[model samples]
Target chain A: MSKTVIKVENLFKEYHLGNIGYGTLREDLSTWWAKVRGKEDPNSLIGHTKTITNKILESHFLALNDVSFEIKEGEAVGIVGKNGAGKSTLLKLLSRITYPTSGSIKVRGRISSLLEVGTGFHPELTGRENIYLNGAILGMKKYEIDKKIDEIIDFSGIEKFIDTPVKRYSSGMYVRLAFAVAAHLESDILILDEVLAVGDAEFQKKCLGKMDDVTRNQGRTILFVSHNMSAVQNLCSKGILLEKGAIQTQGSIDEIFETYNLNTHHQQCIKLDERIDRTGNGQLKFTNIQLINANNQIINSVLPNEKITIRVHFRINKVININNVKINICIDNFYGARIAVISTDNDVNFTTNFNNDFISRGYIDFTFPKINIIPGNYTIVLYSTVNNELSDWIKNDALTFSINEFDYYESGKTSANGHGYIFLDYKIK
Target chain B: MDNDEKWDLIIKPAGSLNFNLKELLHYKFLMYLFVKRDFVTYYKQTILGPLWYIIQPLLTTLVFTVIFGNIAKIPTDGIPTTVFYLIGITFWGLFSESMSSTSNIFVTNAQIFGKVYFPRLTVPIARITSNYIKFFIQLVLFFGFYFYFLFFTQYMKPNLYLLFVPLICIQFSIIAFGIGIIISSLTTKYRDLQFVVTFGVQLWMYATPVIYPLSNIPSKWLWVFIINPIAYPMELLKYAFTGQGIVNFTYLGISFGTSILLLIVGLFNFNKVEKDFMDRV
Candidate 1:
């Protein structure tokens, strides 16, 4: 059995809010005076006299509270969470970038963190020189980087320009070189945070493959944080879900994702009129959205390549005596990547001089002959424009639905889930 | 001991003494790289390049010789005017430059510090090393003129006390780094120190006997200079080279003691603040 490589216990990180902390001479002097007099600190609630819960809430923000976990050697773990969910706070503490308010962390081997790429790259330095400098910053010895210089140059695929100053290289080349250096780092435990968000799609795929190779062939312990669920699923074997500074679930990747989707989308397909998280001139508003099948039946689930119609209802918030109204419904996957767009902007049935001058309430229908989406959850975002200006825009989960698996080709198997987000109708020939 | 040895690393809220000689040894290569970066980049795109290093001290010495020696008629205690001013300016340049740069270590390198982890102390160490290199170049220039005066003119003198010169240089480096890191730690929170650093170093130059002999100060005001840690090393450096200034072992011993004391306080505060500077900076 593999031994435990990382263990963290009861970690808590409390951050002081606003300018009331020790950023001035007066504050520092006051703190020193309080300590000298054996009195409670005037600026902080931590490590001092205990205060009530509400005062603590007002003065301090607990980024991570009572967090504990352990990982064994060669185990790849993915940390998943929304913004401000303490995911980054945990990573920062683990990497030793900052200290926790209370707790301890123990590690049995060397750990390298690629929290960002190209962190210390100097513009005037040549790419080769920068590689060495960046490697040193990440804790590599001189001889170690020297041994891998040629391999690093080869992996970045810009060998011809390796001697040129980094300022002369394109942004793409810069990122490629930075990522190449990080990917070649030899450590028992590697921590990465969305460093693959840059470069082109093909390069991103290459990075994912390299990460997979590291975990499988090299047997390195990896802690990866990313908003791209598909990438996380591809790289990590186990999953950790965090919500509001605490762990909500931890399990296999699939089970964690299932729990994550259910928890976040619990209020599915709510009344659009009540959504306050919207922006626009407020001339028009989206009231409801329904996904209807060919039989005119409402659906909460769908099959691949099925004929469907998305009907959107709207109400006029103000008198819109205008021309050239456009309505667009964006289809986004569960991870918030846009899969396709259904819009009235370029449809033959949409007239060029359309207007809602007198209509107080009405509905528009967009018919898709075959919606070739894969098996997963999706969110619809509604947007409308009047006279080339945004009249109303509603972001995030205007309507939520899931696609169920079906044998579209009669092959007794649906293409493996999450391999791709869309499928094309084609023949072998 | 065996239980503690099982883990390669342990992180906690508070650490002991905050000095890790072993970790500093491991990052020596990083320090070397930082020194190289500072030295090479200082003269990367200039017409004069490293020649400017030589020119800076020469120009300052010429101006001081004319202004203080010729016009103000400040006595050099029988030492030649140019040599007297040159040695003081060169030595002062090293301390002042290192102190100013090291004082800004956290504010300047916050980007790299926020993203990665290394011994933050290495930055200030590298800073002093690089400044010392520049000082060495200027020292060579001073020796050029000194040799000229020695071989061809009657204005030169040499003594066994000159051997103590290296000890004095080391003293200056330690004191500069000690005070620099202390100010850097305090500046992380109180930005008022930011404006005070450059102005204060200038005022500090007058407090020490850099431009004048220690004998020039009245006996009533001598206690003020005695309290300053840098005055001892400054006067010792002058006496070691020219043999025209006062030399007191007791004062030198006090300066050495003060430097070590300041260094301990600096390391403690710097190591404590580095872990959380990201939250404040």
Candidate 2:
């Protein structure tokens, strides 16, 4: 049976906020007393997100809080989080690059972390020299390196310039050498911090192949932290979701992703741009478009091909040719992946309703009537066009959005692969 | 212990002072490689190359003789002024140079430290070893000048007590290393220490017997000089080479004891600072 290679317990890390915590002696003493008594931290609850951010005056913040998890031998764990979610901090702590404010990490074997690419390599030194230096840094003796030098060079595939100084090498070459050394380090545990982001697609594929081999052949435990969700889902068997220095969930890949899918909350950010703003010098500028269902409440979720009302209210700022006024609408997923686009250019006829009061400031409405896409979290981006050409673009984060699985197929069945992706089907003879 | 425990001993944080001897022994190959890099790279692209080693002390000795021997008309304890100043500068050079370079270990190698982890002390150990190569060259020149004076002039007397000079050199190195690592930790925060060290090390030579004889210091100043500790080992080193030292067992004992104390303090501070310096530095 596989033994536990790593065990972490109640690991807590705190940071000093300096004078920004806004407390005099009495308040500070009380806070300190509360901290000692393990009460709710007074400052921890006050970090509410706000609009009109005034120059980001944060003195200190907890990069990582009490994070605790364990991995058995040869287990590959993927740490996934948005920006500022403390994924890198967890990796740094595991790598021993920095000490925790309060925590202990116990591991049964040696750990080698590839936190960044081209780390510990001197530009003035040759690839050969860097390999030896990196080997020593990774706790390998010269004889050990002597045996593996060729293998590392072969893996890195920069042999033409192996004797050349590293400064001359491209960033890709640098990461290749660095990753080669790190992968060959032979530690029982390998910690990676999105190091694959530095390499090209082919090299990333090679590295993934190498990582797969490491886990399968050597039975090494691997911990990976990455922002790429697709890559994480593909590479890791287990997934850990972090949200603002705390773990939201950890479980099997599909289960955690599903929970992540269910739990991510949306505090909608509404913005008025030229595409959706009524202040422009045109016939009509879309200022606001709120999605409504049978219930007038904010449509928090929806299914694909559902009959949803997209109420786009706009007003004219000035009178003009009213020539070719177009509203371009694009629906995008969380990773900025555009799912679909709807535009007035596809309309058969252009309608012009002109009024002097409406020319100065009046409202026009556009109803999508129906949305045909798979179930997903999405935002609508709007752009304004005049004379069949774009005059301005407006970005609405969540305009008439929140899609669900109501997009119908001819067969009336979801694709075997999935329903949420690009679908192209034709009957064969 | 079995293989599982042996792997843990090295990969784990060190718990006691006994050291992971087997791991260090395994890493000896790295140590040797580092030392070779240091020794070879010094003269790699220089004009005079290794000749600069011998040329450095010879010219300094000549310049000092002109300043203190002829101009200042200072006494050299009845020894030749050339030999007197040469020995003083030699000992002072080794001790002070080692101190100055070792002091900036972390500051000079901050890039390397931020990037990866190895035995951080390995750099200093390599640096001290590199300085010895230069020291050996200077030793030969000192001997060359001594023999020349022995054959050509009337000032000639050898001392067998010089056999113990290597031990004194080793002691001076350890003391320098201890002090160096300590200053290295501080320089990580106060980078001004790096700038201060060059001038500080140069000024330190004046307090020791670099330009003057040990006898020139008044007996009343003995207690103050004894407390410094570097003064005695350096002065003893000069005496070992030139046979003109005021060799006292009490002074030697005090300096040796002080060196041991400094070494302990240095290692303790160095270990304490390694964890968080990547943030501050």
Candidate 3:
């Protein structure tokens, strides 16, 4: 059994919403007076719960609230969470980039974080110079960089442009060089945050291999944070699931993934209008989205070739005159790669209904008599545009549903095996 | 595990002012690399390259000579106007540039500082060290002019006080760095201080007698000039080169004491802010 290398206890971090300094001298004086009187800070709302309403009630944001965990030596722990789940804050605290508002962390050895690769790379500096600069920034000594410069160059595969300024290097080469330096850093504990999300598939595979070697062969403790479930399952032996500034569960990788999937897929209908994480002109908004079977019963698990209808209820806040208004819905697999796009542009009645003035609230029904897809969880991205130009609203991950494995071709075979993301109908001749 | 066993590192919200001297000493090579990066990248894309280092103070000296020497008729204590103002501007350039850049260390490098962990003091130290290269180049230019004036005219004079040049340089660096880090700590939350720093350093130059000799000030007002910490270093530089200007031991003592005080305050504040600056910055 390995000894514990990192121990974090009761960590909490709070952040002010706006300027750290009070906006006015009067506000500052008032706060100072409150402090002198031993009263609660006039500007702080530390214990208040945050609501998803339009009113911005609280000024203090709790980024991490009483989070605690321990990592043993040589344990590869994957931190998984949705956006705004405090994953980055936990990593930041561990790396000592920021301190917790309270609590403590004890470490037994040197730890380096590749929160972002090539963080301090100066664009004007040559690739070779940036290598030294980045290496030093990551706490590598001068002689260590000099000894490993050749290996870094060879691994990055940019020897021809080593002397060239990094500003001129293509973005692919840039990430390659940056990841190379970070991968070569010799430290007892390594922290990585979504670093493999960049580069092509082959490069990502190479990085995964390198990460595996670093943990399994070198016996280095690794803390990895990513939304890529498959990659996390491959590289991490343990897992931590963070939800809303708190750790929801911690266990083996499989157990954590199972808990995560169950928690995220519990909600069958998504109240899109209540979601705060969206971007658009705000003229139109998705009110609710639900997946229903042919019997009009709400469902979250559907088999391939089953008749399903996606009902997207929307509200037009303001009446606008537009000729070509269309809704685009894209289906993305669990890895966040788009599988297919279903748009209303091909429907002849889409433009006719939007031209009327009284159409403020309506539902757009997409009936897929025979859904074609593999067995996996999927998300939908819904967007509406006017005149094929300006986007009125766009909501990502508006709805999520899982596809149950089924033999659609009646051959007792499903695409859940070694096949790809889509199922094709076939016959043995 | 033994109860007395010590972990390699323990992180907390705040720490005492041991200054982490051992950690800093261990990462000395990183400091050197930061200094080298600053030097190399400062002139990376410029066409004139290192010539800009010479050109900056040279041009400033020329402009000051015409404005203060000829137009304003400022006295230089009988030394040639060119060499006197050159020495003043060169020394002052080292102090002021280091001070201003060091004061903005946290703001300018917030991106890198937020992403990685290192001794934050290394950045300010590296800046002061790298700037010495520019100061050295300008020093060579000053000496070239000094030799010309010494060989060609009788107005030039040399004295044993010239040996104090190294001490004066170190004193100047300590004072500037001390003040710089303090302002940097405050500016992380109150960005208005950044603007105040720019205007204050400019006004501070006028108060330090960079353009005129110390002798030009009347005796009754001498106390006002002596209180400014930079005035001591400026007067020392002038006395070493031209063999003129006041070299009062009492004034130097006051300046040195104040610098030490400022350094303690600066380091305490820097250490305090380094823990949580990312929260605000």
Candidate 4:
């Protein structure tokens, strides 16, 4: 077995909920008085319990609680978790961006992280200058940067504008250059946090290939944190699943992802209003979502050719006037790739009558006569917008449903599984 | 892969005060690049470019000449008003600019610091080095007018005390850098310090002999000005060229001692804060 490159032991990070700076002098003096008397801090008593009542004081929260794990040399470990699950905090601790509140992490060799691209990039600097600047920030030596300057430029595919300032380059070109510089970094351990979430599909593919080469050929360890399941499965052999600031499971990528999916799927039918993981203005909220058959029977599985209607109920808490109110529903496969997007804006006859009066309660229904999706489990994302601006509700994986195999033409021939997530209509003459 | 081999790094809740010489040496190239970036990017967008470096001190000297020399009637001893004020403001500008920028290191570079890990000390060191280049330019401009005064007239005489010029420059930079990092670390939690630093540097100049001669102050109250660390270097510079200011061993010793103490405290605070500043910055 290879040597253990990283060993984390009983890490716990506590964070205050409100202001991070030193409080008023009065509070400081009181705390000092309490300390002098050998009593507990007066303010520390706040938020001691986890009940989360309206009147209760919730002063602090644990970002990472008693998390421990070890990574061996040449291992690609994927950290999977939802937001606020301590994934970034763990990475930050490992990267030395922040100190763990209580714990020790022993790491071997030099580690470099691409937590963000173009970290020190100056817009006024040319592409070549930024590459050197970013490279140095990632801990590259001047000679090393010089050695790989040509390769980095070629990899970014922006050699034509290498001398031009990055301010003039398009955002795509900018990200490409930034990623190219970071991709060329030579380190014993490379830590990445959602770097593949940017750029086009082609560049993303190139990055994945580069990552593969870096680990497989160069024999370096990797710690990857991302929500993209397929990318995690494809790149990582080991996986760690985190939940509510604790490690829930650790195993092979396939096993851990299965556990993650099972855990999330259990919460699929819960009230949308109870989910605190949503973003928006809070003026409107999604209350409930369901998929129903033509007979108005709620179903979790349906045949490929069967008609289904997705009903989304919402509640408005404020009076507002909005034109061009749009509701967008996206269907994504298990790998977190959007397979289809259906929006009310695409409907020619659709009209939103939300004028000066408040909409107390309403529901939007999207009916599909023929679900041409292949037999697979998929997730639905709900979004609302007013005047083409994002409204008070956006939910990810709001609902999950599976399409069962069926022969649309009634020829007794079923679509083959694992071919793709979408089935096309065809006829052989 | 050897079990007995030492790990490259070990992170814990509290970091040690022992300086990591190996890591700093390893990141020497990064320091060079940071200095290069600062030097290149500061003037990239400006229309006047490097010309601003010369113009800034010249203009400031003109303002000082008008206000202190013409209106306030502060004596420059035997030295010409332009040379005296130019020398004072030029060196003072170097120290003040470096101090202000260094004080903002963590807050201004939070984006880079949050994302990547390098020897955090490299940033302030690079700031000091880059500002040295700017100071060097202004120094040359000061010499340009100094030589013009020497050749075109006989009002000023160069002296052997000019040998101490290099020492004075290093002393000023060290003191500024030391105080700057200390302020930078404190500003991480007490952001109100950011507002204080700008006006503080401006007010600090009055305590130092930037606009007036050290002899102009009453002898008994000279200790008050001597308590300001910058006073020694300013007086030393004026004494070097025009031979008109105080140059004593006691004041230099005190100045040196204060600078070294401030540097130790600054580096200690900076080292402590760099590990977890992202949480609050």
Model 3 chain B: which ten-residue window has the lowest total lDDT? Answer: B1-10
User: Cα deviation in Å at residue A348, candidate 2?
Assistant: 38
Best by DockQ: 4
What candidate 4 gets wrong by more than 4 Å, as runs, is A20-57, A269-287, A303-307, A313-332, A338-375, A381-397, A405-429, B1-5, B14-18, B45-48, B219-223
lDDT of 4 by residue, B258-277 (tens): 98998888989888888888
Better of 2 and 4 by DockQ: 4
Superior by DockQ: candidate 2 or candidate 3: 3
- What's model 4's TM-score? 0.87
Better of 1 and 2 by DockQ: 1
Model 4: pairs clashing at backbone N, Cα or C within 3 Å: none
The residue-by-residue lDDT of candidate 2 on A217-323, one tens digit each, is 89998888886666777778998888778888999877877765554333235345333322224545666667767565547576555456665566555445544
Q: Summarize candidate 3's per-residue lDDT along B163-243 as a digit string, tens digits.
A: 889888888888889999999998887888889888898898988978998888888987777779889778887888888
Docking class of 4: medium
Query: Candidate 3's residue-wise lDDT over A94-204, tens digit each?
Result: 888988777888898889998888988989888998998889888888889999999999999999999999999999999999988988998999998887777887777
In terms of lDDT, model 4 sits at: 0.84
